[model samples]
Structure formats: structure tokens, C-alpha cells
Target chain A: MVCIDCSSSSATARLLPMSHQHVALRRFLRGPLNLRPPCCSFPRTFKTLTVHSSASPSPVLAASITSEASAKVIDGKSVAKQIRDEITTEVSRMKDAIGVIPGLAVILVGDRKDSATYVRNKKKSCESVGINSYEVRLPEDSTEQELLKFISDFNDDPSVHGILVQLPLPSHMNEQNILNAVCIEKDVDGFHPLNIGRLAMRGREPTFVPCTPKGCIELLHRYGISIKGKRAVVIGRSNIVGMPAALLLQREDATVSIVHSRTKNPEEFTRQADIIISAVGQPNMVRGSWIKPGAVIIDVGINPVEDPKSPRGYRLVGDVCYEEASKIASAITPVPGGVGPMTIAMLLSNTFISAKRIHNFR
Target chain B: MVCIDCSSSSATARLLPMSHQHVALRRFLRGPLNLRPPCCSFPRTFKTLTVHSSASPSPVLAASITSEASAKVIDGKSVAKQIRDEITTEVSRMKDAIGVIPGLAVILVGDRKDSATYVRNKKKSCESVGINSYEVRLPEDSTEQELLKFISDFNDDPSVHGILVQLPLPSHMNEQNILNAVCIEKDVDGFHPLNIGRLAMRGREPTFVPCTPKGCIELLHRYGISIKGKRAVVIGRSNIVGMPAALLLQREDATVSIVHSRTKNPEEFTRQADIIISAVGQPNMVRGSWIKPGAVIIDVGINPVEDPKSPRGYRLVGDVCYEEASKIASAITPVPGGVGPMTIAMLLSNTFISAKRIHNFR
Candidate 1:
């Protein structure tokens, strides 16, 4: 339960996990260039490098190499729980003060299993935090107009503080058209170009930062990792995770380089990074050799691979090779448990923020 | 005026000049983080290095080293003229086809000589391109409300295709407020957060790309300097030039990194770049050693320094030390004549585009 400062001598590497919820948004997962995925090998054996204590001088390097797991797992589930507890208190106070509960409306157009599971989890989380949750499920063949009508209704509803349209909307639906229709005030997903534009501009601020990237940054702040003046490299340039993540990092005064599929030598850029945020969906693509010693890693790619050992027949892994990265990085996020929980946590937080802003609540 | 490819054997280095127009926007010239300008030495002697032909194999390295000038100057004046010729033809065609002439309206609140000069140059450029031009001049003591009123008028004027408010408004006026008042549709300056957001997003296209950066990229395209997959470093994060320039480079599929004043060891990043775009307003801050052999240099900083030889008592210089950098770079833009003329060229282009879009001429 202890959160150790990443710089401390006793600190163990922490994994910043990728978002499992976004997996169903498969169409959006491709690199920004929409280039064919570069050839990559997966399920590779992990090898631990010799501990170069003097050369690296990392906190983990200074710590005793244990026979058990060396990385002190960053428990996102626990962190998320703590955040929810705090949010619950705030939600109660807002209700007591104003007699208005924050409301989040989700429009799920299709019944993809993963999308359904994500929406259900979000609803349950919303209810637990004392926020009102509204869901509208439509058949897979629904027209774009149908979705836009639902969004317009939610946007005008004074009680609804936030609106989210589950991604990878049916092929027939124009994603941008539907997403753009959601009023900027109710754009809890932060996918609207105007919000994104604000995020990119120097003096302007976005109403909401997209959830998963926001969570990745929150983890860094919570763990007290300094971003200012650091050389950071972001792998992938997806609109959701990688692009915004780089923008956020830059806003924090970090010198950032974006390495996408089109980038010829991604490892060369990653090797120079003090911090690396990888949202590319290729699991274990970032090998140990690609990392700088004592770097902070935030792997936003959660790819599932076959696992006969698991009851689900598959298990999730991050874009980074966790087994190898844990030994080299000062801190990292583990897949499944890391950024996945933080995404929903951030969505709830954003919803509360939206409601508070809308009502002029303190 | 042979526009030699940067990769050619006879390729001469081009100096990408920084914008002289933006210099008067002193308040906006400060870095994004509002960090104090880093203490930097200037007006240093430019020393040429020994030509090691086999070591670098650069085109300039392979070409006969001339004593008078080792690098071939990139004539921004000529290139801009060529682009204007192309644009003029387009404007004539559109006018003939639709009976609509592109009109550009400029709002100049203060009487700063530089701003006035820039506006006049733009007006003249518009005239040369057969686009209608409008000018509104107000006293230096004019209120922001007065400026906003003018902008609102221009916004409503269907004949005014593009609207530009001269920068560095009076100290009492809020710059962002005034800039935001201009309708996004008519914002030829591309300073609108929405336009910036669209520029940053993966698939969305901005109504207008900021002129100076657009000009810099245009110069690159004209010269056939490949941007895709190249390591490009943009120094300075000023909203007008540096930030947009980085985004533009990234959109071209280059692996882009932004180095601001807060960035430690700026040379380290610049040294790694195949293309270096220096927009920081410090004169000659980037030296030859900071550049990689055969790297393309785009100097967007036009800083004034004392020069007894000049009739005006001062001369303009770029952020990069031209004398030293030319030998190392494959191409560069010279100060005053480089990005300066290109900025006006781009403004005319954007204005034409705005008019075309408004009329649905294309």
C-alpha cells in the first residue's frame, strides 16, 4: 500500500499500465499514419541484464536484487479505490450543498463484448461514487443520426454533466460527425477537436483531458516524478492516448519527441528519453535495450495474447516488455492493473469537475 | 534559381530566415512556459571548420569549397515570388469562374512602425495577387472593445474573406481576448485554438495553418527536402511560430521534438536532428557545432543587432549563426530575405484559401 518516491534508494520499479477499455476501439488503434503495422516478434523470452550498479546508479540498481519479483508493483486498483473514496466524499458534499448530483450519460451504439464490459464497469463505478449514470444501448446497425440525436438530447439536459460516446461506433456511423455533435460542455471524453485544440494551444486549456492519458500523468504526479526539463519520447501518435499524452507532458515543460510507426529508429529516440510513454499496440515491442537506464515508463498499450494458464484463455500485457523493463526502469506501469483502472477513475473525476463547473460549485 | 534537392551532390545550404514581422510582438515572443530568456552570448565570431570530405560525404562537403561562400544561399525572395505567381494564376482562375475576388482585411490598432510595415507589405502582396485588401487603423490608445468591434464588423462582412489583427496590441488590451473575437472561419492568422486543435489532431484539418510555419514548410517542400521519418528539432515553443512549426513537421510524418528555453542542453537535441527549425529570438544562439552534417536549417528568429556597416545602424540576424552553419547544413534560409518574404506569401495564400472556402469556389 506504500507509495515510494521513484527517486528513493528503496524504491522498486512501478509499471504504468495501458488501458484495456480502449481495446474495442480497434479502428482507432492504428498509428496516425495508418501505415501497416511494422513487423514485430512477440511472446519473446525476457532476459535480465547484469545489474550495472555503478554505471546506472538507479534507485532500483541500488536496491538488493531479490529472488522474488524486483519491481514493487504499482497497484492501480488500490490507487483507483482511494481516488473513488475521495470523489465519493466530494460528490456527497456537492449534493448536500446544491441538491444536484453529477450525471454521466454514455451512449453505447453497438454490443461488442469488450465495449459492453467497459460501459458496465463505468456505470458501476459511477454509481459507487454517488454520481447518476445513464446508459442508452442501440443495435449495431443504428444510423449516425440516431446517435447524434441521443448526444444532442444529453447535451441540452441541465442535469447531465458529462456525455461519452463509446468508441469504434458501428462502421456505418461517421465517428467524427457523431463525436463533434456532442456539445463541448458535455464532452467528457475530451475527443472534440475544440477541446483538443485548447489542449494544444499555449494559453488555452481543455475542458477535459482524455481519461487514460490523464491517468498516466496523474500516476506520475502522485508518485512525484519530475517532468520539467526532461527529455521524454512518446511511442505512437494516436489521437486518444499518445498525442494528448505528449501535449500534456510538453505543457509540463518536458522536451518531448513523438516516435510513431513512420519513425525509422524509434529505439534510438527511446534510448535518449528520461521518460517514455508507449501507446503503440504491439505488445512487448519495447525491449530492454530500447530503454535508458533509470527512465520512467508509462506503457499505454494493452494487448491481449493467448494464455492457456488463464481461465479466460488470454492475458493482457503492455507495449513494453515488463519482465525486462522492470529491471532497467526506475518505474513502470503494469498492464491490466495500471492505466486501465486509472482511465475510469479519471472519467469520474472529469465528470465531477464538469458538474462543478456547470453549477459554479466551489 | 535551380531548387536543388538537399540530397544532391551540388546541393548548397539554405538559411531558413526567421520572421521579421513577428519581432514587434514582443509580449508574444516570450517562451510558452514564460521562463526567463536563457542567458546566451551573441555576435560571436563565425569560424569555419576544416573540410573533411570522406568523413561526412555531404553534398556541400563533396562540392568544391569556395573561399567566398561554401554554402549556396536559399533565395526565399525568389521562391516566394514563384509561389505568388502560382497563387496569382489561381486567384484569376477563381475570379473568372465565380465572379468573386478574394479580400483580405487587416486590423492595425497601434502605430508601431514594424507592425505598420508588415501590414503594408501584406496589403501590397494582396494587391499583387489580385486579391482585394482592406485596412483599419486605430490610435495606440484604442480600447480592446474598439478593436473587437472592428473585428466583429470584419467577421460579418461577406466580402472580407480573411481577417488579420496586427499583433502586440496595447498593453491594456488582452491579446487572447481580441484574437478569440475573430471568427474562426476568417482567422487567416490561424491563431484560433480550434484551428490549432485541428492541426494537432490526427485526421482533422485546420481552417488555416499559421503563416510563418506554413511558409517554412512550403520552403521545404519546394526544395524537396524530405520530412517523412526524419529527425526534426523545433527550437522555441512560441504559439505563432515554434509550436505550429513542430506540429506541421509532425503532420508531414517527421519524428519531431520541440526544444524550448526550458529544455536543458538544447544543442544535444539539435545535434540529433536531420532538420533543425530555430524560432527562438536569440541571435546566433545555435552554432555550427549544434548542427548535424547535411542537416537542413530553418532559422525563424530575426533578431536585430548593432551593425556600423549598415545605414540603419542595426542589422537582422537569425537564431542560427549563418556563416558557421552554412558549411555544415545541406540547406538553410537567410535572415530578412528568407522566412520574412515567405510569411507574406503565406498570408496571401491563406487569404485566398479563406475566400475560396467561403465562396465554395474550389
Candidate 2:
């Protein structure tokens, strides 16, 4: 799916001038770029990257934009690039020293475009980090046993250091049972309940944290945004992003409140947050009025809303309206480049870690 | 540990007049009682039971009492008794029809008197419910291997339906490794991270929910307290209670918030809560002013402070000062009889469920 600012392509390349774009492009295409702050230098054309100035508000979404102050753009692409570069170097070091390559296996049950895009992105990230990627795509009507058979095969494959079954599997299959089949050691997605349980418990650490939430947390860490003892509010309580995000925040010692679909006054809770990471896929749900000024926002929601003026029928936007939050928030990650790139980068890092742990490659 | 209102004896017998006490005493003295509400009719005397009615508020802490509205006491003992008695009948029926009696094996690692008392009470409850209880007491300095050996044996035993490893194992042992050793099917205490993870997820059922939080929720259910669409604030972020309680509340569709030690102005959050469950161990931490009027308070903390007037050197008081909170809350659990006995009762219930599942003893 059109990963907006959360995409590393934008995180790393959003601020790149025309001249730097070529340098970034050449380095990225060559693979294994240097471990630098501006890491991801993908060469994709940003036809949809609409630049908004702090002085001017777009007429189309003018009602949503209330704050005049420009928020410091949290360059997730650069940070993800840096993390990917680190993983690349580590993977290379492990390969050179131990004669082993980190491998990740992806099992796709159905042909959902968004799921395909995510898997493709993950594979690309693995390649950049010198990790081997294996993929098995099944038709929509695949039986539960067929999916389980693939997972069982991967579980036994010594070369496969990590396994990820793309989520939202076809309605016929039982999701929990399938995910539970991936041996915990190879669970790179960190969707396993045990991993989540470990994450939720104080003084306990998970083998691998779920990628998106981990990325959101990594952004906060890299940006030096204080989370410990801060009042944080997580919107949405989904297992993948919101719940884990809240658990991660709690582990960081933040007093966390989770506001979800049943919440009577979600905005009231959001306004009390020192940090807000919203994963509800509602376009522009969190407005300037809901945010506490100077609060940090990490929007995980990437909703494609209809935009008749755009070349594409729809334009990608995060749960928070960027125009409004940018002015209100002291710092906020833009939709495409913010948390998106980090998810794939984390996947690569997890694969590298699994390989290291398996081989005792320290 | 001075088990107060949460104690079965006090819960079912505290309000019983002299003549009913004898009838209750006879029924409790017998091995297993019938499926009934107000089930726990133990003969534990009131030497430690200090009654503090609203008519005679303790002069020492009188300043904290502001509201005069008396709260409806949520008798956990009676509720726990009812649950236990129901289990008692089921166990008898299972034994007669299937010749399979549910057996629980508890492993205690330390010589802590409080832990011993808790174990004894658990064993007593098992007998009262017609469930067989097995005990393995190890020295304080027991090795990890020794503990695992017992767990493995229990796991293999055909008779054992449930297994529990008492918490606060000596400092020398690793807690997580030991707890993880218990087979998930027999994890009656439900401290297993996998069990906790299932509790956290939506549309997923845990093999067993942890006892304390399960008891708290059971109390709410029995009291006819609606958690759905309600605002719930769980104090403390402890794995055993606060976190699971929040997860359970969320599953029940309540908007849940976790307030911890690091939280700034926790009272502000508690005041907004329609249901407040303060599990933090600090004595009298949640004051009258902290609670919203007509809120339901489930004080899970059982802290002992010095009491010169009592026969025991110290008396048990919950996190919320009952004198103040009783007036402010619509319903409040007493320290001893509130959530204590329910913990043991749940252990029996989980065992019964395990036996039923294992033997298909319908």
C-alpha cells in the first residue's frame, strides 16, 4: 500500500536536494550503504510527495489545519536508514566471521495488494542487509493444512533464521493457530503471544518485539524524546500496533492509557498525553485540538483517502492530520517516511539477531 | 498475612449472627459443601478481624473521612465460597461419573511463613472443593534443576490436572525460566507468559487467566457491575494483577488506564474512573479524594502496618483506606475478605476446568 512518510524512501530522501538525490540514489542502488544518519537513499520518484510550507495552508484541507507553528519533522527514513546500515554491517560481519547468512521466510496466504507490498518491502530490506529471503505464495483458497505445512517446513529449515506469516490471512484459516506454529526462536514478527506476554511484563524482555511498535519506540529513542515517566496515550487497542505500543510505552515507564473504539471521550485522554502514538486507521481523527502542544506524535495509521485532484484516485495520509499536528506538535513523523520504513528495518534487524542468537555469533 | 474481608471465613461468617454461625460452622467442618452462594463458612475466629463501622470512624484517621454515604461491601468471601461450592459439586459429580478427581500440585521453594500460610489455605480450599492437593516443599536455596524435575513429574502425572509454582522464589533462582517450565495445560496459577499474552489479545482465550485478576473480575461480575463502556483505572503495573486486570477490562470493553508509581497525579486519573482497581502495594495510597463518587474500588493490595491495639503486632489494610473509600465508593472490597479467598477459589476452579477438559468429564 502507498506507505506515505513512514516509508524509508521518504524518511531518508525527503529532504534530499536534487544534487544529493543522485548521490543517495547511486549509493542505495549499489546496496549496503555506509552507516550514516541519512541512510535510505532509494531511487523511487516522489510524484506524490506534496511539500507543504509552514507559512501556507492548503485550501483543500484548510479546516483541519489550526496550528501555525511548524513541527520539527522526525526524519524516520534517515533513522531507519541508519538502523538498516547497522544491520547490514552486522550481517556482513556475521557472514564473514561465521560463514552463515541470516535468512527470513515469508508465507503469504492470499494476494492482498497491501500485504504483497509489505512483503516486497521486507524482502528488499533483507537484500540490502545481505540477508537471504525466501517467499511462499499460496492462492486465496489454500487450506489450513497447506499453510501449516509451509510453516512446518520453515521451522525445520536451519537456514531460515526468521519466519513471518503475513497477517489478515484468508477468513477460512485460523490465524492464531497458524502463527503459533512458527517456532518462537524463528518468530521474527513477534506476534507470538509469549513474546507479547514477555513485552507486557515488567522486568521481562521479549525475544523480538513486533516491528511497527518497535519502530515507533525506536523513533522516540533516536530522537531523544523522553518517554520514561511521561503521560502517554495510545489510540486503538489492536494486537499488532496499539496494544503492543502501549505495552512498549509502559516498559519505558510511561503512565499509559489506551483509548479505543469503546472509549466515550478519546480526545480527552489524548489531550493528557505527553506522547501520542495513534494506530487507528481513521483519516485525520486526531486533530490539533486533541493534541497537547509540544507533544510528540508518531502516527502509525496510513489511510488512503479520496483526493480527486491527485493523479492517483486516492492520497495516503496518517491517522493524524499532518497539517494540524505539524503546527501543534513540537515534533511529528510525516506519514510515509515516519514509522513505515522502520517496520522493514526492524524485520531485518530481527533476522540478523535470530541468526546471531542461533549461532552464538557474539 | 492477615487475610481480612477477602478471607472466606469473614466473608461468609462476618455478618452471620450467633445461631447461623453454628450451622455455617457445621457445614464448613464437613468435607465439601453444596453449590451455593455464601459458601465459605470457615471457622477462623475474629481475633484478627477488626471491625471499623462508619458510626465509629477510627479517631486516628478521622480527618480523611469526608463523605458520609456508606458503600455496599462487595463480599469476596461469599462470592468465592459460591464459586468453590459450585466446583465442589462438579468435582463430586466428575468423581462419581468418571472416577477422575481434579488434582493440583503446588511447588513452594522458600520457607517464608507468609508463603506457607498461603499454600496451606490453598490446600484447605482444595479439600473443601473435593479436589486433591499435592505439595512439594523445597529449601530456600533449591537449584533450578531441582524445581524443573518436580515440574516435569507433575506434567507427566495422569492424576494432576493443574500445577502452580508459588511466587517470590528465593533470590538465587530465575523466576521466568522456572514459571515457563510448567506445562501450559496444567498452568493453573496462569503466571505463564503465554497465558498472559492470550489474555491481552482480542478474540483469543487464555488457557487460564491469572487468579488474582480473574477473582477481581469475577467479583465485578457477581456484583452486577457493568465493565462495558465504563472507565477503569488500574493502579500499579504488576504482571500478576494490574496489567492483566487492565487487559481483562479491555476485553470486557471497558476503557482501561494503568496508573503506576511513576505516574504524575494518579489521583486525577482515579477520580475520572467509574471503576478503580488499586493494586499498588503501598498502604492507603488511594485516598477518599482520589476516588470518584459512587465508583467501584477493588483494592488488591494487602499491606500490613503496625497496630498496637491488635493481638498481632501488625494488621492488614488495603491500598485504599477503607474508612475513607467506603463512604466515597458505591461498592468496595474489604482488605481480608475482598480478593484473598477468591485467589484460592480460582485455583480450584482452574483445576476443575482442566480435569473436565482432560477427561471430557461432562
Candidate 3:
């Protein structure tokens, strides 16, 4: 569980000169990236992501670098920052007008470091957005009843507008029972089946859309990418990310297909997609040839691969081969700077929304 | 509006010689069906459904007709009958053991003749299976509160194991509000958001699946069709049929794709599918060309088409051009004798299942 681009580390990553890396990435993509074979043998279109330029000496090199990368970088970090700013303004206004500060309560019941880190980052995100944050940490051996009691208390607390339970609870506990115990109104994480059901329905709205998928859609909207009438492929069917992502894409009127591990010739569907969102945690599963020309790509998988060159001995990559996909996709999200930052941003935004809804402030 | 093969009429239609019509249909398909082009201009495969036979006039003609139709008829009518029998046995056993009869209460809140007929047929079906039936009829102008009151009463009635509110309430009523009023325990229709949400999630089962989609999957299972690892394309995304049908297919480990009106080049998707379920209301929308060789098709669409040859002046047809699809598909459910009766049969099954779940009966 090397969370190389998790929220805690994304701040430093964001400060790097983006244009410089994009140039280097393009050059690297043109060179050794071509050597890597696709993860699975499948038929793919021969349309390669071509970077248009002329080879020239150092003196004339400056004259040839005019075209941008094949795909526009989605820069989710920047978009997420913009949303957080918007949420911050809204949170301040609500507090000034209604004297109500939005609050989010998070419950963690295990000693998993990844879970703890997620909770800490979420709290930090809440504070940054002017939302009140509450935390309840129980030992790994705690009973399910203990977790339920905390949820019940949070459900009753007027100060808490949103409640989140860090996932991957202890194996001894029934995760469904614990999560269902959260009040639907306070389910900012949107794990409740009622919320999911509403999200899937045409005329209904959920209390909150799950953070990761919501962020993915938000990036597409902010970038003015049209989703309606697009053939989108969502590669994964996990309850939290892939399933809801497909539902959101469909809600926007995209003809959506879900390709999972069981699917044969995954490239056949991928090549037909106008937009591809890969949340399957297999690094570099989607090769360059699998993409339709100028298709948008949103890679949700944050997989860490061994990289002895990096200081940590591992570097983060998405489910797609970024070097290859960037050459072909019309627009794409980068691994570390892409969907990672948006998840917490969405959490804060959901808290503010829940507070407004609960207080009748909007 | 013209329910040509609705549950009420299917009882008599079942007495007709099914094989004789199939032979006639095959002959008719070989002649005039070829003249009918696809409803929408799309690319199609050239594989024709040719019946293998020799050119014998009379003497050898009897021996020449050995090859069967390319696709096997799914026979949803017979399967629905088998399910009804199973429910009947279960109802009897439960009643004998616990002195409790399975009860279904249907509330019809309008003067729509079709709704009234549906209720009558349902009541008749209940009586045939020895399940107690309860009915509440309200005027077309009845207030929403009046309907809610009836729903509340049924919710409190312990004898009622299933509660169904006839759809298309008077325009003045809020359908969502009224439907939500039914206690989820007795929500045999499975329209509640909670039930739908549970159905969408992995490792969660709904109290009831919507009748029609459940029946579609039931037919496939009874026919010994394998869904796991298959590519299934669900045409149409209506919450009642298409959406849940896709969810159900995905639950069974088939990689599912949803093609709706907005989908461009739908034939490309359908042609690759191993199983297709078409619920779009367009008559003859899915052509033989759209089907893959040996694909299993479940046609949920019951559109009415003009037929001066019939007594009704029009006849019920599925979204598929049956003459064309039956030739290409490995197996298909017929328009009239297919998903229509299965809807009511599944309703009975759900009612019985609810009663058993309530009483903790095996």
C-alpha cells in the first residue's frame, strides 16, 4: 500500500513546474515507452499518438517545439483546488448568514496505517475548507457494537452534518451492517444503498455522490468536456469507484459499458469508447493502442510500482500506461496529480453541502 | 396500450399448437421477412438463417426437413408456468405448516381499464395458487392522502405479505411519495430506492427484484444458459426493466454494457454481445443484423404493431424483429409468449418469497 500520490504527498507534487514535466514526459514517451508490450494480447488499432515536430540541432531545436502533447492534461489537482476554494467561500457565507459551521465526523476502527492516514488527511482537508471536524478512533479489537454506537451518536449530533466511516474495517466486523447503520442524511461518503439506488435512478438524486467518482465527473465538467452521447467504458465494477463512475457517466447520457477482469478482449470495448475511466488496480493494463483517437481518459487507479530510481523505491502510476495514453487521448488525468487530490476535496464539498441541506441554508 | 399477449390472454394462447406456428413462422420469415430492412440503417452481418432442406416437391420433402430452426425459442410462457407451479407448492406447504396463507394486496388508484384488468388477472392468479388476495380500488380523483392511507393500512396488515400499488396514478399524485409510503418489508414491486440501491451493490440482495427483469434472468437460468464471463448488452436503460436487468447480469459476473437512445452505432455493441436484453419500446428496433451468431436474446419490449389479419387489428411484438432475430440468435424469447406472462408470474413468486421470509419458513 504505497500511497505515493495520496493526499498528504500531493501538495508537494502540485508545486512542481507542470509544463516542464509534460515536455520531458512527451520526450520519454517517444523513446523507451514504445518498447513495453501490452499487459494482455488483444487486437488494437494502429493509430499511434504522434508528437509533431522536426528533428534539429540544438541551435534550431527551439524552432520545432510548437505542438502540445496529444492529450490535454486534465490537471485534476488544479481543478480540485478551484472546487475547494469555491467550497471555502460557500462555507464562509453560510457561517456568516446562518451562524452554522459545517461539521464532518469520521470513525476509524482499525490500526491500518493507510486508513489512519486517510482519516488524518480528511480532517486536514475539512479544516482547510472552514468545516468543523470530529474524529473517533477505536482499537482493531473493538466490537461492531462499539462502532455502531459511535455512528448513532454522530447521527444524533446536530453539530455533525456528515459522517464517514473509513473503509476496510476489521474482518471480524460485518462491514455492511456497520455502514448501513449510518443515517442516510449524514452519509456524506454516500455508501448507503438508498443513496446509491437514488443515484442509479433517472429522476432521483442521492444525498451525496461518492467522492472519487464525483470528482472525476467534476473534472470533465470544469474542462468543458462533453459527456452526452459519448461511448464511455468504465474498467472496473467496484462499489465505491467504478460502479458509481459508470452510473454518473450514464446519468450524463453517455452510453456506458463496464469491462472487468472477466471480460475478454478488453481492448475491443476500450477502442470503441469516446471516454475511458480505468479504476482497475492493474498498472499499465490499458495500452496506448487500446484508446480511440482523441478519446478522453480518466485513470482512477493509483497503483504504486517498483522503481529503484525513485527515492522511495516505488513510484505511483495509474491503471493506464500514462506515457502511451497521453500520446493518444484527447484529454487525460495524470496519476499523482489527477484523481487523488479530488477525493478529499469532494469530501469537504459534500460536508458543506450536507450542512447547508440539514440547516436549510440553501 | 394494446396488450395483445398480456397475462390474461396468454392462458388461451398457450393452448395453440406452438410448434406448428414456429414452422409457419420459419416459412414466413424465409420469404417476406427478408424484404424488411432494418428499422434504423446500421451495419449488419451477412449470415442468413437458412433452413437446410432439399428441393423435393412431395415424395422426398418429408425426409428433407430435418434441420431445426437456427435459434431455439426460449419458451418464457412455459418457464413462467413452471415457476407458478413451484410457487403454488410453496404456498400450500407454508399454509399447511403455519396456518398462514401468503397474501398480496394491490391498490388500484384510478379508473384506467387496463389497470383494472391487470388487478383482476392478478387476483385470479392468486386464487389459482391458493394465495389470499386483497384489493383496494380508489376513484380517479382520489387525493394522494387517500392512497397513502390505504398503503399505510396494508403496511400494518400482517396478513399482507406483499403490497403493490398500480402505476400511473392520477396526474395530481406524486408517484415517488406514494410509492415510498409502502413499508419496504412488503415492497414486492422492489421499486423502493433502498431496494434498488441494494440490488446495485455487490454482496447485497434486495428484498425483491422488479418482476420483469427478475423473470428475464430466471428464464435464462431455467434454460441452462451460462451468464458468467459472457458479454451482455442491455438495450434501453429504463429503471424498471433495462437498468435492473443490466445490474442483475453484472451481479452474475457477465460484463454488462448499457445501450440507450444516445448510443451511437449500437449495432457495433450488440453484434459483439453473447447475450442481449432489449427493452426499448421501439418495435422491430433490433434486427437480425444487430445480433451475434448464437447470441441469447431476451426481448422485454412488448410494442404493439398493426396487424389487420388479427381480430384486434393490431398485434403485440417485441423490440426485436422476431422473424429476423430468431434466425440469428442461438435462443430468443418470443414477443407475445415471452416476458409478458413472466412479469405476473414473478410477481406471484415475489409475493410467496416475502411471505416465507416473514414467517422464517424454509
B182-261 per-residue lDDT for model 3 (tens digits): 99999998889999999998768999999989999999999999999798999878777778999999989898999876
RMSD of every candidate to native, in Å, equals 7.7, 12.8, 11.7
Task: Give the alpha carbon lDDT tens digit for every residue of A19-91 in model 2.
Answer: 3322332222212222222212222332222222222111111123332547888999999999988988888
TM-score between candidate 3 chain A and the true chain A: 0.82
lDDT of 1 by residue, B231-335 (tens): 899987777888899999999989899987567766667767889998876666776666767789998777766555458655667777776677678899998
- CAPRI quality of model 2: acceptable
Residue A171, candidate 1: Cα error in Å is 1.4
**How would the candidate models be sorted by TM-score, starting from the highest?**
1, 3, 2
> What TM-score is obtained for chain B in each of the predicted models?
0.83, 0.81, 0.83
> Interface RMSD, all models, one decimal each?
5.8, 9.5, 13.2
B1-362: candidate 2 lDDT, tens digit per residue: 32222222211211122233223222221112212222122223312212233221111121234435489999999999899889988999999998998999989897877667767888988988899999999998889999999999999999999998876678889878898899999998787888888888766799988888899999999999999878899987777777899999999989888887676656657767889987755556676656666789998866665555568655667767676678668899998789877888888889999999899877
Q: Native-vs-model 3 lDDT?
A: 0.75
Worst 10 residues of 2 chain A by lDDT: A54-63
Docking class of 1: acceptable
lDDT of 3 by residue, A179-232 (tens): 989999999888799999999987899999998899999999999999998888
